[model samples]
Target: MTSAAFDTSIEETVEALTGPWRQPRQMLHGQTYDSHASIHDDATAQKLGFKGGTIEGPTHFSQFAPLCERLWGKAWFETGCISAHYRAAAFEGEEVQAIVEKPADGGNYATIRMMKRDGTEVLRGSASIGIDAPASALDIRLTELKPLSDAVILRDIKLGMTTASQTVRMDFDQNMGELYPFSLEQKLKVITEPSPYYAPESAGSSPWGRAIIPMEMLSVLFQHGSKKDRLPVKGPSVGLFADQEIRLLRGPLFVGEDYRLDRQVVAMSGSKRTESLWVRTEVFDNSNAPVATMLLNLATLKESYASYDQEYAALPRS
Candidate 1:
């Protein structure tokens, strides 16, 4: 592409795409782990000071697809990436809008954000297309992380720890297990954008000629087997998605297709209120070809852990 043509594509005068207000559903109300209700449970959320069961952060990812597709066309589905830091949680029935700004610098990346009807920012980050679409929000944030300090819940978690490859699939009606109990068929009913590409019956009309999993469901699919991979984080405590990035290398991951997942602890950091475990999961097709990647910062609440302070005090000082 010529510099002039690229400049014309992302002129400063280009208007940002804003999506319609949509209410994302809370599918995790029944989510359980460590023999107890998860943070998504209403009671569990209230105890932690949240209004009610909060919608999953990734659920908002669906809202960005149409807007991004408008900006980058088909490339948005194949190599699209959304890197966001969740600023606040949104509950069911709360309307939210997604906005994607055209890059003023004529790059393949655009700044993106979501806002609740009450003007509260839900999440903010970047949306980019292609492998070379400049540095992502998480890519820049990862470099600015402060070292893990006074670790408790995530003290034992070391960077570079990789889990064994696990084979997984996301069939339309198959429930995604404990972490995500809902299936693709169930999600489509409430998904922010209804795509014929994602429906089995109309999939033949899609460019891929098969039903493709929605980008948001890719979050459920990647973490579907997380419980069985058991990393060393002391996690009877509740955790939330602090920040996340989903990038498709060879995507529009198909429905009912078998894939392999490999996860690694890429980094770890902590704040006064939460300890974070930054994990990166790589998805591969049956032929062992790379398909997609997800980077998640699971921030475990300090107050939710019973013996955080006691255990941290026991660790030997450096």
Candidate 2:
């Protein structure tokens, strides 16, 4: 199940598969949302107490591909799922490793984790093959969420609200826009796992016959045009990914392929310090065939919203 293109030696045992330590690059330093600098900007993040601009969470996904591919083979690209709940932010220059625990019964599902060299956890979740792979990490986390209440930032959003389907594509050198200002070519230069399967000239020689988008880029592809959807969540506040799940259906989504994305607000949740908006985005091909899906929990920090307490106090008590 291993390939030279994946370019990494996996440390495997009867219990787990461990990937090499990788220093994920930060490409979101200039990222903007709602016309303001995002948490990926050092100055903005420092205002809220982060030591520095955080590397976007999905950037870590690339490190797990080699391990997951070794465990499941090509099918991991076709029907694989990675569902993670962020435990802490990872910054540039920090070394992190990915581990996928082998299923006890050798089934199609397993738990996964990423940790810094200091043993600080970056994220923990599940990975599996098959659309029906037993409840993923986010699936379990969703059921446990306390219904959102006393919210200020996400008070206007409602469940099942969908956005207009929009078209998206990722060319090798095309910048993905404000939310992700870099191009696929720039990312490939530093991707944790380099695969010819993701390159134009060499892709035709691969099993898929065309370049397949790396799992991490799927996040960019789906989110590229999302801001235009304008789903009505109060903002001018900072939000970060708290949980995320990317699942492929009839995929190995190709690089340079055009896909339509439709997003929906599927759930709302709250914690002591943040209110979360859970969204589900579906990707479809030109012929309208289902390609992939993503579940993201965009958690807005309460303290970052200046009017949070004042607004919450104005709400009628139950």
Candidate 3:
């Protein structure tokens, strides 16, 4: 079904996962993640003659994290999980909506999408959750843990060394103490405005009653799409890790401006079963403006985290 039909029932709230996402304009370009930058000025995306800027894949995939959390509960952060491949980009100013539909077999399967308000599909994906799956297995029942560092970015090596300037909106000179346990005053400084997709109540009131980075936006920024080169792999094997540590210095990200996204490499090590790399990222809303930053450690294995890719290829419609 189209976004219109899907969105027609926001109140029902019976939707599977995603919902009527607002296609806000100003929230564009200013904020981004690894994948977002990776795709913007790449070779294949350039040569294939794709129109407009290449949309990052991780940006799209993480967009749904909020949906899962909203439905499953904030604590779901430690419980539920998702993993998917991005098929395409959702351009700036495009009308976007997200929806989830169950597949025929029904068991732990779904069809999800990010669509332009006009009904033109932007990003189409699949979804599955092991509901009955033990919360312990998902770590939903686990106690929250604080990072051993001020947010561990790739084992050390500050997040943004290679990140060059690109257009972004908003600006921030954050007081690290103000984040984490964001104060009433701090909340006012960040979420300067509100929009449908992610609305901060008001300057005096916090978005979801807390001052923090727009989780959805932040998730997309972490995308490693065209922005960076994929880890070199020898086999079809893949490695995956859940959970992350974020330290938001500032921002509920405003609109109508330019920003810079900085990425710095952290650590790389090899194991008998896998190889991995870690990196730190700092997002500045406008030129030289520091809003919020994150120390993300992304990992991949020399061999698939699952079994052999050959067996994966044979699985019915993942």
Q: Whose TM-score is greatest here?
A: 2
Which parts of model 2 are misplaced by more than 4 Å?
1-3
Estimated TM-score per prediction? 0.94, 0.97, 0.37
Per-residue lDDT tens digits of candidate 1, residues 187-223?
9987878787888877787777778888899999999
Which is the better candidate, 1 or 2, if ranked by TM-score?
2
**Candidate 2 structure, TM-score to reference:** 0.97
- Residue 152, model 2, lDDT: 78
Cα lDDT tens digits, model 2, 67-107, are 98888888899999999999999998999999999987868
Candidate 3 regions with alpha-carbon error over 4 angstroms: 1-18, 24-38, 41-47, 58-66, 77-80, 102-111, 117-121, 126-212, 217-318
Taking the tens digit of each residue's C-alpha lDDT, what string does model 3 give over 6-82? 11323223446545565332222223232222123334234334454444333444445455434443332322334
Of the candidates numbered 2 and 3, which has the greater TM-score value?
Answer: 2
What does the lDDT read for residue 149 in candidate 2?
A: 81
Q: Please list the C-alpha lDDT of all candidates, in the order they appear.
A: 0.87, 0.90, 0.39
